[model samples]
Target: MKKLNYLLIAIFTLGLATSCDSSDPAIIDEDDNQSGTTITKAGLITANETWTADNIYVLSGKVVVNEGVTLTIEPGTIIKGAEGQGSLASALVIDQGGKIMAEGTADKPIIFTSVLDNITVGQKKGSNLTIANVGLWGGVIVLGKAPISVSGDLETKQIEGIPATDSFGQYGGSIANDNSGVLKYISIRHGGITIGSDNEINGLTLGGVGSGTTIDHIEVVANQDDAIEWFGGTVNVTNVVTYAQGDDAIDADEAWSGTLDNALVIMGADSDSALELDGPAGSAATEAGYTIKNVTLKGAGASSVSKYADLRDGLIANLQNILAYDFGPTSVVKVNGADSATELAAGRITFLKWEIVLPAGVTSVSSLITGANAGDDTKFTNNATAITAASAATVGANTAVFSWTYAKSVSAF
Candidate 1:
C-alpha cells in the first residue's frame, strides 16, 4: 500500500507526461459517420458508440441504459456536474443489465470532477473535493438485480432523492446472472450531497449489484457520505481507496455479502469511523456477512474514533491482518452490542493478531471490549489465537501513509 503523498505525486507526474498526446484519433474516425451535434443533457447512450463530455453533460433527469447496450467514455475526458442542477447534473448512470466499459489506463484515467476550476496561487476554493460543493452535482448510481435485500418491501419502490422515478428507475428483477459492467482505474471526486441527516448519495453506490459485475482500482475523494456504499450483492473489490469523506469510509448493509481485500482509508480530522457495518437493527435477518483482509486505516485526531463498529444482527465480520493507528478516546475495535462483544471475543468475529499504534497518551484495549457473561476471557483468547495463526508470517507489511495540504482548494459550483 503506497502512501497518499506518493500516490498523488505519481499521478501528478503521470499527468504531466500524458498532457501532450491529448489527441483522439478515434474521435475523427467515428465522427465522420455520426452527426456533429453535441450532447448537453441526459439521453440513452447506445452500444459500440463512443461518448465524450462535450459541454459537461448535465443529467437533469435519469439516464436510462437499454438492454444489450454499452456506454464507453473516452480516456482523459472530464465530466463536470452543475451546482444548481440538484442531484441530476452528475455524470453517467448504468441501469440494470446495461454495461459501462470505462477502461481508463494508468496514463489516461477518466476524471469526474466539479466544474469550478479557478484557483489562486495558494488558495483552494471551488475544488471538486469539497463535501457540500455539489458540482456536476450528482454522484454515480448503478442498479442491478444481483441478490440484494432492500430495506422496504421489494415492490415497486423509488430510489429516494432521485426524481424521474418512472423513467430510469428499476422495479426489481431476478438476481441470477445480473451484470452491470466493468469499472477500472476511475476517479470520482467532489461528490456526495448533504441530502439530510445520515442520508446522502456517496461517490459510488452499488445497488443490488451481482457477482457478474466487475470492480477494480476505484478511488473516491471528498464525498459527503461513505466513499463506497454496498447495498446487497456478492461483489468482490480489490485495491480501493477513500480520502477525506465526511461519513464512514466504507459502508455495507442490507445483507451485503461481499469480499473486500487490500483497502486503504485515510481520514481527515472531522471524518467519521473507518468501517461501519449495520443492518437495519429492526430487521436483522436481512444483514449480510462480510469477509475482509489486509486493511490499513489511519486517522488524524482523537476525532478519529473507532476503526470498526458493528451494529448488525447476524453480522459475521472476519477481519484479519489489520493495522490501525492515530485513534481517539474510543477503542480501535468496538462491537456495539453485548452479544456482538461475546461473538467477537469467542473468535466468531475474528480480529486476527493485529497492531495498533495509539496516540501519545492512550494505552488500553479494555474499552474496545466491553459487556460480558463470564466466558469473556476464552472468547478474547480465542480471537487472539485466531489472529496469531492467520497473521504469523505477514504482519505490518506495506502500511499506507498519507500527507495532504490543508490549503483550501476551490472548484466551480
Candidate 2:
C-alpha cells in the first residue's frame, strides 16, 4: 500500500510537471511546479490518501474507494470528470466501509466539475463550462452500511447508474447511524450522465449513507437528473442548493429517514418537479420518513409547467417553513396515489407554514392540487390540519452561503 501511494504520487507529480511545462508559460519556476500533483485517475483506491488543493485530480472512468479505504480531499481542490455514456460513464464512488473526509471551508469550497471545464488547480471557476452545460459527465456516489427498504424487504439493493454485476454498487445494512464520512462546502456541476434508458446518475447520490456522515453546504448545478437523491438513508443535510437541473431538484426515495434544512431549489426551463418524495417499496422497520424545513423552491415560469412538489409512494414527510413560488400552472403539491393521501389525512405527513405563489388564474391551493377544472378539493381534506396558507414568503435557504457558488456568480440567487 505504501509503495502504491508513492507510485501514485510520483505519477501525479510527473503529470503536473509535464502539463505545466508544456501548457502554462506563467509557471516559470520549478518551485511553483513542485507545489501540486496532477492525476488522471481511474480504478480503486486500496489505501488511505489525501488530495491537496494545489493538485488537480481527473477522473477518466469510474473510480471507487474500496471498503476500509479513506480518501481525504483538501479545501479548494478541483476534481474533474471525463465525458462518457452508458458503460463508459465516469464517477467517484465511495463503497461501503469507505470514507471520504472532504471538508472544505466556505471561502475555499471543493469543486467537482466536468473534464470539459477549463478550470485550473487554484481557480474556482472555469472559462469553458457554464451552468447551461449539463449532463457532461457522471457525479458522486457514496454508499454505506445503513438500513434501507426494498420491494422484497431486502436489507440491501444495488444503486442506479451502475451495473448490477458490480457488487460494490450495493448499499444498505442494519446500522442506522453508520458513518460514511464528512462532506462540507462541496460544489458539483455539469454532471448526471445517462447510463441507460431512464437510468441517469444524479449530481450527488447518497445510497444508505448514515446519520453519522456530516454533509452541509452542497451545491449542484445543471445536472441532467436529480440534483441530489437520497436512497433510504438517515443522513441529514443542510445548506443545500440545486440549480437548473433537468429532473427533480431534490428527490428522496426508498423511505429516506433524513432531515433537510435550509435548501434552495431553482428549476430550469426543462426541469421537472422541484421536489419528488417517495416511500419504501416494501414494509421495513428501518425505512422511515423524512423532515424538510426552510426550503425555497422556484420553477422557471408558467411555460415550464412544473410542480413544486409531488409527495407520494406512501411516504411520511414533515415540511415546515417552505416558500414555493414561480411555478407553472401545474399542481403545487400533489398527494400521489390513494395510500399517500391516506397518510396525509392521518397526519403522518404534514406541511406547515408554507408560503406559495401560484401562477395566474390559480385561485387557491385546493384548485392547484385537484386541477383548476376539478370541482372539489376533497382529496386534500386530510392535509387541512397541518397545511395552511401564508401571504408573505418567509421561508427559504440562506442566500449568504451561496456567495461562493456559480449560482451566485450568475445571479441565479
Which candidate leads in lDDT? 2
The sequence of per-residue lDDT tens digits that candidate 1 reaches over residues 1-413 is 33455456545645543453321111111111122222333445445465563323334344555556787776544554446444444545676767777775555555665546332212222343354443235577777776555555462234433554345545234573567888776667777765555545678887767777788767777776677887766677776777677778888765666778877666756567787765432243333367777776666656656454434443566677666665666644545666566555555565675555555455444445444445564343344321222133344323231112121122110
Model 2 CA lDDT for position 196: 74
RMSD of 2: 6.3
Q: For model 2, where is the 10-residue window of minimal lDDT?
A: 22-31
Off by over 4 Å in 1: 1-39, 43-48, 52-61, 85-91, 118-136, 152-160, 171-173, 280-288, 338-348, 370-413
lDDT of 1 at 191: 71
Error of 2 at 95 (Å): 0.3
**Model 2 ranges off by over 4 Å:** 1-37, 285-288, 371-391
TM-score of each: 0.73, 0.87
TM-score of model 2 (CA atoms): 0.87
Computed on alpha carbons, the lDDT of every model, listed in order, comes to 0.56, 0.80
Compose the digit string of candidate 2's lDDT tens values, residues 44-117.
77778888898778876788888998999999999889878876788999999999999988789999999788
Candidate 1 local lDDT, residue 309 = 46
